[model samples]
Target: MSPVRRGEKLPIYNRIGVLRAERKMTRAELAETVGINVQSVGALERGDNYPSLDLAFRICAVFDLPVEAVFSRTEFGAMSAELYRRPDLRPEPQSDPGGAR
Candidate 1:
């Protein structure tokens, strides 16, 4: 990846809001845990601010997840869709041929 020049801001997508909701954690809680202000958490969630490498690692640590899981350069899809995806490779279940109860 090329270095970002001065005054160049790249949009970073994140799943902090979803993760927080899943864990029942508030913005204030996450902020306190990560040593930042609650507003900063909101900004990060809204994609209005980019987190430093240290901040990203700290945030990931709070959820016990890797940085990639929390933050991504590309937008993420629906959590439910990702979690409950049915693979086409799996074969359908076979039923018994004999009439047995």
Candidate 2:
């Protein structure tokens, strides 16, 4: 394997941590479910290592999510922020309800 440069960006990013938290799953639990070591799970979550195709499929199966939802080449932002961002539907500023100017 080639050494990663200090400032090099990862080729792929994942939502494993977010998905695990959403499901209240631990690294150990996810590791066991995916037939991998807990350390490997940590590495994957940190983007220190990429999973093989089979391993990726296993992880997706455990989460019951499509691979695209779990992994992406682009960075994934917070779902709440993304959902609330609406340049086309901005809310009008409200005036003070009190009579004071």
Number of the top lDDT candidate: 1
Global fold similarity of model 2 (TM-score)? 0.72
TM-score of each: 0.80, 0.72
Per-residue lDDT tens digits of candidate 2, residues 32-70? Answer: 998999999999999999999899999999989899888
- Counting clashing residue pairs in each candidate, in order, gives 0, 0
In lDDT terms, how accurate is model 1? Answer: 0.94
Candidate 1 — which residues are off by over 4 angstroms?
1-7, 89-101
Cα lDDT tens digits for candidate 1, 30-52: 99999999999999999999999
Per-model lDDT? 0.94, 0.91
**Weakest ten-residue segment in model 2 by summed lDDT:** 1-10
